[model samples]
Target chain A: MDKLPVNHMQLDRLVLDWMAEVRTYILKEIQRPIIVNTKSNMRDLVTNLDQNVEKIYIEKIKQYDPNAQILSEEGFGDEITDLTGPVWIIDPIDGTMNFIKQRDEYASMLAYFYDGQAQGAWIMDVVKNEIVHGGPFQKVWLNQNLMEPPVERSLEQSLLSFSGIHLLYDHFQYQTMARAALGYRVYGSAGISFIRLLKGQLGGFTSVLKPWDFAAGLILCQALGLQVKTLDGQTVNVLSSNVILAAQSLVATDIKMLTNTSSNL
Target chain B: MDKLPVNHMQLDRLVLDWMAEVRTYILKEIQRPIIVNTKSNMRDLVTNLDQNVEKIYIEKIKQYDPNAQILSEEGFGDEITDLTGPVWIIDPIDGTMNFIKQRDEYASMLAYFYDGQAQGAWIMDVVKNEIVHGGPFQKVWLNQNLMEPPVERSLEQSLLSFSGIHLLYDHFQYQTMARAALGYRVYGSAGISFIRLLKGQLGGFTSVLKPWDFAAGLILCQALGLQVKTLDGQTVNVLSSNVILAAQSLVATDIKMLTNTSSNL
Candidate 1:
């Protein structure tokens, strides 16, 4: 396979077209009976739809650029150990629990990474029919409108979305962070929560998330000038479970202070 | 005014008609600049839209039935100490903070009571344009389709939504309940959260809510045979702030076991 030079406009069109196809396919399939399967635990869920959607993306990405590697939630993509070349990271259905139960709040996330650098990203909120896509080189687009960069807010001036279990256990001093922020919420889906954060509807979001869970959101956050990093301010490793604290820069700093002061990390 | 007889069909039509008008009025008002104001606290919000919408409801109800009384969030309606005669309970905009910030997750909630008995109830999720309305006699409708009674689940099998402050402070021992249930969530609006419960998308919801917050929600729960009460199993008073646990009977029973064992009321 030849090394294909990246073309921003062409990449946008191609990825959007693929996502549109995935959306139509899922919309039809969801109305029928969805075969649900449990993964990791009884509460951790996956559906046949997740597998089928990943298959579709894998086929398209391979055809679009044969040399491009793929890392995906389901095991339908490449087994590359290094980010030494063009790569596609995909979460076919980012909120499988919501998808299997409420049939809402789920999203399809896809992002392009090359030699450890994010190239582009897209998130299609399946139920709301909202698409947010962009990259570091492009302004983020929410549906058809270019999203204005969100106003930065102090930690005390923002609503924070957090994981319930983390707060209950006081992990990373989450309890203190909750009290210090304006208010707290938990919507049960990282993709939906990400949308709320990008819209400035939230101060920040802290959760233990997988690479696919943060892949597209991370790219979009970078494009919009929001901070994305490990809760401890370490660099994000794109292949493992990462404790992410994505927020406006000021809130991120405040949250870091709380976590740093906590006896337990 | 003159001891109006409870007419299920007529009330449904009138309430639906009024709701349609309310929806149109809000859709227009939302597009213009929204004027926000602080209520009891900075987080407890009210908007110009809330007052305007409540005013519209008050005017229409008065014109429709000259003698009917109203107890509303905005002081545009009468203040009655008791739920006697035809009384309309209205929360012009539930989740006003959401309406002001996110522009989603807010709802217009209305319920009718006569001689302290629920006659009809309606909740419109303004942004989603979905209405759930019915009464003790008529079947509940989400848009046009009648909602099937939600399947009952055991506490271990359901998702529970709780107010963040309640859980953080262990109000009602919500932390114990949080650990006892499958998991916990918070959408920040009682109406939106109630929709999830009625659909069986959630196992239960526990919060300290005002009359307007639970009026329509209480009626819908009764219509669907779900349990509505204080965590201590006291009857809900619809004229004041009260602690509420709205859930499937089996789940409610399970949650009661946890609450009963807690030292805090």
Candidate 2:
């Protein structure tokens, strides 16, 4: 392996510290009223906290690694066409609707990439105070404990999760795949859903997700020996939104067979 | 109103204490493996904790009010065809599938009825150590704090939840309702879903629920002045499973108009 410019261990520690600070800020801020606004549609919500958290991350990342390119949900970071250098991706509030309405089941996700490859990632269930973080080169950790690679389970014996909108709209035959699984669940947050997937609680998860939404989770899922790919069995482009499937290899294949499609999203 | 057989306050205290004990047991037992079995189908699951929790409630109910008719899931309680006496309804583990799979989002519920009238009801989010309890004669309480009644919102402005099966199978046009709402969520547990509803987090919730599943929630929802009824706008029978809807009155009416049905379930 080639030596990297920045110390990986030092960067990891710094990112973890940033995550802790962000978590504390969110916990205290949400106790009071928040400014909420919609993005593309009524269902796509963004909160003041989301912008604040993204700013915090961007500030910290620039302070530490000034040359790092950034891609973020709230658009607080740089806009580079390619990930040719150190890149930080952020989804300050992955399940903004849940945060604004249910006040739970939302997450903050961040991923570090160098030369278009994952270096480290973190997905924090802010309300639960649990963080699942790691990368392809390191063992995943849930909070302070080492997380085991999830055991592979057949689609028939595993619970599946889908974006509720996709399922309701019958996107890519999501309803059909849902019926084929042992059961279906919708948590509405890609980061939280990824936490469940990494914990072996979900057999598979399928949804149309943006870059920041899936970036952190994709790293953690890959570290856990899970397959992360597009519905058409292609590599997901981290710069664009895609209908993605993250699951055990066997379960992913089963879902593909059930859907039988080619890049529908 | 007529006087009840048992002192409501004292019984409430006793049940609260019992809930604490049950919560502790569940937290401990789930750390290790327990027996898992299926009930009506592969999706309908029951674990040892379910049976044990039901037995705990039954033994305590019998000890205090021996003549009380018990209607419970898991068959640990008495066989009762009518809610004519001092009746206790228990859903030991309301989201057994989630408990067995996700290890979260499940709840334990108990409701008391005197002469078919609700006296008190409790729904405990066991993992979170929070409980929502109260009845028609008393203000609803979420743990130590008094819970305010939920504010009414229109279907388009509120998040809706439904049974995953119903949504996937398009039962009663759940898909249409989902599209009409601000968003859709599926937590897969009636108790957890009811907790969200009572907290004013959800616009509405619709599901096919058995007696035990709806018993405790029905009381809490009614106490909060939210409407609880069948799809056909009939009173929900406390002794049988039915397709039930619980929501703000306006939201409920809106849903009924959308479905335009007459007791299909």
Candidate 3:
């Protein structure tokens, strides 16, 4: 087994302090005017606040470790093509649409990678002022409290969360998956949806997610024993956009079976 | 205009106080073992806590008005076939499925009817300690603050909230309804979804709702000038289960046109 790094505790403390500052800025910025712009498509939204938040993370991370490599959503970090030593991944505002529309149900996510392996992760539930952060070396903490590992839930008994467009369009046979589960819901925010899974309140959450979208969630799921994979049952690659399914083991199996059956049909 | 009831303010005050008591009981009961059972189907759930909560409302309402009739999800309520004088409609736990499954998104709802008219309504977003309550003659208050009337939204710019099952099944042409809007969401709780509409956070909410599911929402929608009708655009009968579509006026018109166009094809 790999040992916890000698400086891991210190680094984690610094990240939490930086997050405190980032959160304070976000809480203030939300009250000000939000300037929204679309990327990729009209439905894919970004805001001045997203850029501003990312800048904070970049500045703070650089201040903490000048040699650390960073990857982020708003282009504030290194444009590295591969995960390397002492790498930081940040999604400064994971649910910009929710932030723009509801001013709630959004989060800030960060993850730490070393030598192509995840070492630490953080997801801040911005509205609720709760944080889920930990890594392979530490028990996950939801804010200051230690979070228990999620209990396994079967597909038949648990609610699944998926994007509305994906299920509506029957992407990956999600419509049939919804019917097989207890039910399905979509909050339109990946970070909020992931919180439901971390809390064991959801069976699964499937989405086409970018690196930052799935980075922190992947790390947390690893520590919690939840399954994380591409919808086709391949392991998720942290450096690329993939169709991700995060779920308890049994639910993942059921989803795979449903997908296989649909494909055969 | 119907004159504001001579004792409407006083009655509203009484109901709010009753809600506070009910909220306290719920906050405590959530920590206890929730005794759950299914109704109608496995997906349709009811809990012992739901029954216990309804009994409190029954006892309190009967104590306050001996002649007042009630229709509720639990059998604790009166079995009146018609909307009569001094009738109370209650769904002690509006999102019983969510409550039993997720625990945070559920609410307790109460509505008042007199002489076949929706007179007053209250929906307690239990976990948030927020109450959305009002009637034909009074302004709706979210928590202690008065809520402004919802702004009208066009179909092209607004997010609609509909049940996932309905949209997946092509019920009422919901698939086309989703495609026309900016997007759609399903929180799986009618009262919570209605709260989103009341706040102008969502353009509409559609579902096949029971009388208890929609009675309070109907009263609030009337007060706020939002449209509430069946999918075929008929007025909702408070005494009967119906397929309801509640939305801003212009959005409703857009949906009607879309539904009309799809049927034509």
Best by the lDDT measure: 2
What digit string (tens of lDDT, one per residue) describes model 1 on residues B26-101? 9888889998888888788788899999999999989978999999998889978997788999999998767776
For each candidate, report its DockQ versus the true two-chain complex: 0.66, 0.80, 0.78
Q: How well is candidate 1 docked (DockQ)?
A: 0.66
Q: What is the DockQ of the complex in model 2? A: 0.80
Stronger candidate by lDDT (1 vs 2): 2
Tens digits of lDDT, candidate 3, B138-240? 7888877888877787897788999878888988889898988888888988999888889888888999999999999999987988999998999888889
lDDT of 3 by residue, A1-265 (tens): 4464436666778889988999999999889988999888878888998999899899888887788899999887888887767889989998776787678788999999888887899999888888888887876888888888777778999999998889889888889899999998988888888888998889899999999999999999878888899999998888999999999999999999888988899
- Give the fraction of true interface contacts kept by model 1: 0.52
Model 1 bad stretches (over 4 Å):
A1-4, A261-265, B1-6, B261-265
Model 3 misplaced regions, further than 4 Å: A1-6, B1-6
Which parts of model 2 are misplaced by more than 4 Å? Answer: A261-265, B261-265
DockQ of candidate 3 is 0.78
Clashing pairs for model 3 are: none
Highest DockQ scorer: 2
